[model samples]
Structure formats: C-alpha cells, structure tokens
Target: MKILFLGQLIGKQSIAFVKEHLASLKAEHQIDCTIAVADAVTGGYGLGKNHAFYLRKLGIDLLLGGEAMLSKRDLVEELAQIHFVLRPANFTGIGNFGYGMRHLHTPKNQQLNIINVMGMMGFHRVHASNPYQLVNKILDNPKHPSPFTLVAFSAIASAEKQTMAHMMAGKCSAIIGYGAKAITLDAQIIDETAYITDVGRISAPFSVAGFTPESEIERYTTQRPRKSEELISDEIELQAVVITLDDETGKATHLQPLRATYPLNVKAPANTSAESTTP
Candidate 1:
C-alpha cells in the first residue's frame, strides 16, 4: 500500500517541493497515500484556501483538480472547505464547490473510490463535461461502497492519446494521468485491468512543462521569430507515482515513478574522502 502520485502543482515552487519532502517521504518511502494536482498551485493559476490549507499541512492527503482549478474565481467559497479537494467531474458550470467522487478510507480498510475527471481537452481551453460520460456516472453513483477505484485525469498534452484514456482504463483501479510533461511517464494497463500513470511535473527541473520556458516562448512569439529564451526557475522538482497497493485487494500491484530533486530539505555534506577531503 503505497500510492504517491503527484503531478501538476506548478507554483510556489511546487509548494516548496511539497513542504520539503514530507518527512523524508514518510520516513523513507513508506508513503500510504499522498496525492496532488491543484492546477498550478497558486500564482500559476489557482489553488487558494491558503494553498489548500498548506497542502493539508504538508502531508497532502488528497487534491486532484484541473482546468487550472478554476483560476481563482475568488477561491470558490474558499475551495469549498476542502473536503479532500476533487473538482473535475467534467466541470460544466461548477455549482457545488468541488468534489466529483469521494470515498477514501484507507489505513488498511482500503475502500478508496476517488474519481475526479476532465478531458474534453482541458487546461486553459477549459470547458469540460463528458470525461467519458462522467466516468460512467461515477461508476453508477458512488458516494459510498467501494473495494477500490481511482481515476484522476486533468487533460492536456493532447489529451493523452484519448481512447478516453483507454476507456477509463477498464473502469478504474488506477489511472492518474494528467498530461505528463518533462518526464515521469511509465505505468500502463488499459483493457486488461486499469492502471495508467503520468506523474511528472510538480514544477521546475529546469522549467518547460511547468512553465517559464519563457512562458512557452511568450506564447509562440512572432515579429521576426529567430530569437527565443526561457528557463526561469527556483530549481524544484518532485515528480511522483509510487503505487504498490494490494494490501488485500486494493490491487495496484506496482507503479514506481518517483523523482525528487532540489536540496530535498538539506543535510548532505557527509561524504568526503577524496584523499581525506582533498587536504
């Protein structure tokens, strides 16, 4: 039971590299549930309510969203009191604050059922609604009852080869895609049992898909276009994806795409032996 999966945070230096790597990734990779996707976590687009309560105080229980998380229309009633932050179920007129499927109870009981969809070509072009008919009506109305179900998509990167994301990966067990950008693109499973992945982009490992590749060359600049430049950064990186569930049928048997760069909360001056530290 691992399940890390973070992508697309894009701002505040990806929330200071997830608050400096949440206690060494749950004390050296014992992570049991840490998610992300706050549509450019503030100043890159949205994500408020005090940065979603400081990413649930740096533990990040949940938060999957997109279409720039609705670019701050006054924080949607403070992102609707953060009841685990979902928001994508096709987002057509956003009436309710947020949440498009929910039912997580892990710590061993493991009855997940997440959901959150998007893809109808999301991101800045916005206008969603029909992420495969709202994931078949959230697996036929799910607000409860679950053995395992996951699905977090936020389109872009050309909608990740839409066959409706391999047709919702045969009705969900894992499919956290979200437009991968400069790396982290591994897991796959479509039509034999659901498991798709894309965990890159928490922002800046030399910026491009997390922005500041000169804001995409100033949106394709013109007027004698032989000049180009970009690479602004605060030097961050935290791609994620570490699903190895099946703690008795949560069934995500393997998915490990993690990457942490940046001083990772410091403390690294201990290996000195080039002839006794080059005396």
Candidate 2:
C-alpha cells in the first residue's frame, strides 16, 4: 500500500493548498491513503471540528495531533466522535482528549495500525507521560497482528525524536517525527522501518515556519509577550514523504520524499518525485 505522509498544515491557505494538490498527487500516483499532521490546522493552534471534517472530505485519511491537540476547548468535547483524528497517547492530565491509536483496513484489505505519541521535554503547557514507555507497551504487545504499523512521534527536541525512531526502528513499519516545522534530510529505512526527523510544514515558504517573519522577529526581540502567530499565504507548497509497504511483510520497500509547489510557479516544478534512496 502507498501512504502519503504530509507535514503540519497551518491555517486556511494551507488547507486550500491541500485541496488543490491532493487531487494532483492522486493523479500522479496511486495513493491508497493520505496522512497529515494536525498541528495548527485551525487558527494556528489546534484542529477544529469543522476543519477536521473538511480535511477528511479533502481526502486525508488520517489526522494526527501533537501537543496542541487540545488547544481548542470545544473540539476537546467532540474529539471522541472523530474517529479519524488521534491525540497523543502519552498526553496526561485533563487536557488529553481522544484516542491515540487506531486500527484500519486499506482498500486492498491490508491491516494497518497507527499510534501517536508526544515528548515531555519542551512542551511546558502539556503534561504527558514518557513516550518511550508508552510506545514500548503498544508495540511489544499487539492486540491484533497488523501488517503495517505506523507511529507518529511529536517532539520539540531533535534528540528525543531521533531516539524514538531508532528505538522503535524494527518494531513498527514507519516512524514520522514532527513539531520542529523543518524538514530533515535524513529520510531512511532502519531495520525495515521508514523514519524521518521532521516532515516540515505545508505553508508559505517565505515566512518562518508558516508564520510571518516580522511577527516572529518582534516576538523574539521585544520583552512584550508574544501574540498569536500570524500565518502567511503568499506562496504555499507541500512537503511530505511517501512510503510503500510490502503486501505480505508490511515492511517499507520504498521511501521517497515528495515536494510540490502550488499555482504552478515557473521556477519550481509542480511535483518532484524521487526514486527510493533507502535500501
């Protein structure tokens, strides 16, 4: 099965970009499922109920949440109703609202299991348990023998993300890390598991991680408390990875990084698909 994993999407323009390019992606390749990070999907905070349903209609099969999962209180009350959305399993306290793991079946009858976890290091507002311990318990004991198992680890620290990927290299089919908002060049397969440090963000490329550079600068330079980040919509692009899993084994046979620019700019190609670089 071919799974297209996209980076964190911020604001309305990013969602529009997804609606525009998702069709192109399907036309270019036979994508069985599309998964995207749900951090800042709403007004640069959390995934809202309306936006969540709209994204699902746009063809995103699964939406994974990070530390900002519960940023919207109204969404928190309705999270249990959204089956396709997942909150971090390790998230503790009253803020933690939805299920972190889900089992699904592809169109071709492939068993798929997805798990979401968050790190405890940098997220001060969120209280969470150890992701390492939670992931170990989930993978060590399987409720069902799924051919494909995917883990989405959201962390602020690079070291923590890398450690989780390496620790669960052979246990799962793939491990995708996010929350840094910058795509890492290290996309490889370790022990048949596909791993990438950060999938990047799908938003205006000119700004600072989807926010206006000037606003971010002002926040960093001045002592005045930082305001809500402002998202830019000048030129948007999709940064993601495509993982192809073996039918029988569920191990990743090919891992390819994909980047596509919207509005068909002259300088950059519409879609760039690379060959599998990992052995």
Best by TM-score: 2
lDDT of each: 0.64, 0.80
- lDDT for predicted candidate 1 compared with the true structure: 0.64
Scanning candidate 1 in windows of ten residues, the lowest lDDT window is 270-279
lDDT of 1 by residue, 208-242 (tens): 66655654565567434332222335467777776
Candidate closest to the true structure, highest lDDT = 2
- Residue 247 displacement in candidate 2 (angstroms): 0.8
Which consecutive 10 residues in model 2 have the weakest lDDT in total?
270-279
Question: Model 2's lDDT to the true fold?
Answer: 0.80
Task: Tell me the spans in candidate 2 whose CA falls farther than 4 Å from its real position.
Answer: 228-231, 264-279
Clash pairs, model 1 backbone: none
* TM-score for predicted model 2 compared with the true structure: 0.91
